[model samples]
Target chain A: MNTDTSRREEHWQRTRKLMFITLTIWFIFSFVVHWFAAPLNAMAPDFFGWPFGFYMAAQGSEIIFVVTLFWFVRAQHAIDKDCGFTEED
Target chain B: MAIIKGDFIDNLPKVYLMYTGGFLGFVLLMAIFEQMGMGSDTIGILFVAFTIAIYAGIGWLSRTMAVDAYYVAGRQVPAVFNGMATAADWMSGASFVAMAGGIYFGGHGYLAFVVGWTGGYILVASLMAPYLRKFGCYTVPDFIGTRYGGNLPRFLGVVILAVASFTYVTAQINATGTIASRALQIPFEVGVWFGLSGILLCSMLGGMRAVTWTQVAQYIVLIIAYLVPVIWMSNKQGFGMIPQLVYGDAVQRITELELLHGMGTLDPVAGAKAGLKALSVPFAAAGDSWQFVTLVFCMMTGTASLPHILMRYFTTPSVKAARQSVAWSLLFIFFLYFTAPALATFTKLQILDPNLATGIIGKSIADVQALDWIQKWSNVGFLQIIDANADGILQLNEFFMRGDIVVLATPEIAGLPYVISGLVAAGGMAAAMSTADGLLLAIANALSHDLYYKIIDPKADTKHRLLVARGLLLVIGAGAAIVASMKLTSILGAVAWAFDFAASGLFVPIVLGIWWKRANRQGAIAAMIGGFGVGTWYLYMIKWGGMDIWFGINDLRFAIIGMPVSLFLMVVVSLMTEEPDAETQAMVDEIRIPTGETVLKAAH
Candidate 1:
């Protein structure tokens, strides 16, 4: 009983942390990165011959989004396993 | 509220063929028009009678209509039929009329929109559908409120959904007016009136059943209407060839490419320094950078967020059906999508190819004039051209900024004739009308069902809810119609913003709340508030707050911010707050699995 309770609690803690990280990334991408579009555009190219501002707007947010979706799935799946949440259940 | 049970309406095939004589008349006329090289104004006189006949004459045949009849075709819609209906709901006039325009106008840059809209479905099917169906609510607000166990989040969602939808519906009305103005030889606003009336009648009379059936029919018209012209023009131009050649030296060197690119908002001459070959605008940059990235993000997420699209999922029989239906929608939509890029490529070549332009109209057929096909349309602001050096050679590079005209003008430019143009106009209006009415109805239903019935007047009777819904419809319909007439921004632009708000604000909370067992009331609330607040502020900044430069980018990034914050806040708040009770936790498990086979788990 104690082990199961501890496992559930641990799963809860992990989900909580993950959501924070994901959202923070989302917020930064949406507000901070977007808010700084002009400066980034004014800045020099980083990698891949793509301009910084242009790259951020064109592909960066999408990368984050793809990452966010996959991350959410992975995080949730881990918690589900920790809690013994099989589809069969 | 659950679907009201009915006998006859329950077993009706929601997607059964409705190829009546009246509707066929429309198809036939559209066919003739394509052969004749005509426009679409004739659709008004022809199909107006058919539309009215169906509404009044055929509508009277059904005496057993109920809320079940009105919404979800009594939830008896087969998955495949529902898929077709859903595709119609998804592919509006802006998409049909403007997608090719994006390709024509932006070259390779705007292809992101084509990919973004289609890709968004993967998320919708995976994340949103089955779970929402498991809860089985009448409207979005009900699901949000019930999930959160409060009215605040529901109200907030209602406001957001309303704002997003109003902005969207206005654009559809604008498209409707475009059809009327072009077809009927009247002001553009005249078309809006006809379009608005069609929407109002379909919505008020059919409820869900009427809308669903009409949408399916309209979708058929829209697709056929588009294909007839393209194929007909392609035939004369040569099978699978797009360049339209006439009998006599092709009377004029018709410049379609110049017309396509020249239609968008012109950038400052300084911004145009990249040369006439490039463009920079509110949604994209001159040289093509990251704006497309955000726009795609917003569009993809926005798809899941769009109220009209979500409303269709509720029509499914089960959660699994909802998921599967989305897959079907993607498949059906793929047909049009696959063709669109081809059309764009062909149209671009058809217009820009020096060989086609010069040979057909330039060399042999010189000094041609007098046809409403060319002159009148150019007069009314559909097509444009620039002979930069006045050397008689039209430059294809000039049309770098045209908005949504490729789909709008493709038929006419292809020489599909006036009647085909009329059908295309009707199809565009149908796309706009079907989706627009659904949106307006959603807002009204949220008000009537969520605000008035559930929140304010908790004990309200059935008739009162219906009355409120109908009343709100009238007010919302009129207001949105008026807003539609404004035409200050591009329809595609407004729709994208709505999708972004949905993606960043609503989709995260709604999907997680149902699927993720740990998602709690606090998390739902936090996610909604955080995402919606930031997303709104982001749009407000661009629309009203005036961040047109420096930090300026597309509205999609703003949405990207909101979605993450919302998801993050939801998690943090859920953890910090008290755990769910065992019963609530069990409900969460049930909402996810919904197979009724799993043993109940502890809520906390």
Candidate 2:
């Protein structure tokens, strides 16, 4: 019983940690980039003809979001397997 | 016969692959017919009829009387297919038809919708989808009711789901009406009936099973319809096949064109009409960054809380699949979101650049009005030219077009073949009808499963329950159609309000029900009523009663206020009241792991 409780705690901690990291990245790309869009547009060079902030808003953030989701899935899958918590499908 | 008997259900990938091939072949045949001098209107009608027929056929194939299949598609959908279906379910007429138009008009401020919506899938994957699946509820209300262990929370869940989803479904049906009116040359009022029947034909038969399979097919058609014209336009403009990357140049070109057209300059005659902003400019139409940020936040939370979207996860095969399915959903949705800005840039370029063959802004009014595409769209009241200055040529200010026509009219605007126009209209119908199907199902299922079966009569048999669900689906779908014909609001506005309502009311309770072990029934009920009531009240006050804008949050983002209120009340109430029982806490812990059988299913 003790081991089971510890395992659940460890699994949850790892999962929560991963979720935090993923969400932090999500927030940065989703909000932080857009919030600083004006300065980014002025400071950074054109990216394949797009201003930097516009690229992030229109294309770059979406790409990063997709990558972050896939990364979370793989990482969470590993955590589940390591914790012996994967579903028996 | 053998394939229909069982093999078809087993080989989803194979069947869908062949279906895609068959659909493309049909489109090719239509193209040949156009080449052979088929009438454009006939071709348009055929395209709409054919796609709806295919959806109906799929509905027939997947039709089921079984409780599980009707409610959750027997919980056997693979992650990838569920992702496709969810993509179709998520991308309504707003995303498919009006999104590019929004980007074109609102500039960078509107990318909030794209970013917030896709970013929402991240929330779903991490916080909601897997746990909800593990809880194993047929509807969002099912989860709320079971977790809180009462009928009041369940009833509140049903009410919120109905209101939000009904508002959303009406928008989708309105979108379908717009497409149908254009395609069939029918009145918008009559066209909504066409849209409603197509929606009901699929969902009223097989329920979620029908909706899931038909949505997958619709996703394919909509993505193809969206991509074909944009790619063709890009290649025509010497951008090659990779328009998503190359279209940045078109945005730059449009910015130059805006300057050339005297974007910020004042001319007394055109000053009233100069609402066009530079394409790449940030916070131009939004007035400030705060409004943009608040709008993004509202849409993100709203995306997470939408009942029809969350219900898609319940159809996946397992909890693991649910998590992966969200990722897949985002990926499928990404195809359209990433392309929308490019589509907006290119379509605007087509209109504004006087050097292009498709350019209309500087063209003679008679010539522009004589164009077949212009005449057709104008006849439907979607496009107009006033020549406000009595100038012979059409100025930028003289042109008036509805955003809803942007995607549907893209092929015509780009001077692509009429066949492509037919294809785009069909795709628009698919987008609208698929979403309408899902929303109607979500509303009806909550009524039948949560309100009727769980609350009114727990002893009701499965057959009777499904009968009630199907019957209610018919009634509710028709009600929505009637409301849609009334045109209560613009498609995007109603959709935004729907999201705000869902986020304000449902987000707190659902998230807390998962993560917070001590969330009592009192907290849950308080959160739902308090949040929803606050959102509705704020919306009414701001939109009609002339209240001042709080924190620069507009009527579209009333959730910005309601969500915080709900969160505060929920935490305080949960802590003040008795904690949930051990069984409920254990169920929460079990859902978190995703390894055990579904708790609610086992209990029932």
Q: Pick the candidate with the highest DockQ.
A: 2
Model 1 lDDT per residue over B499-556, tens place:
7777777887777766576777788878888888887777787778976732545564
* Chain A TM value for model 1: 0.75
Reference-based TM-score of each model: 0.76, 0.97
Can you tell me the CAPRI class of model 2?
A: medium
lDDT of 2: 0.87
Instruction: For candidate 2, write residues B62-159 as lDDT tens digits.
Output: 88888888889888889999999999999999999999988877788888888888898888888899999988899999999999988999999899
Q: Ten-residue segment with the worst summed lDDT in candidate 2 chain B?
A: B276-285
What DockQ, between 0 and 1, does each candidate earn? 0.05, 0.67
Q: Among all windows of ten consecutive residues in candidate 1 chain B, which has the lowest summed lDDT?
A: B244-253
Off by over 4 Å in 1: A1-89, B1-26, B29-44, B47-65, B68-71, B237-289, B357-372, B398-402, B548-552, B596-604
- List A-chain TM-scores for all predictions: 0.75, 0.95
lDDT of 1 at B77: 60
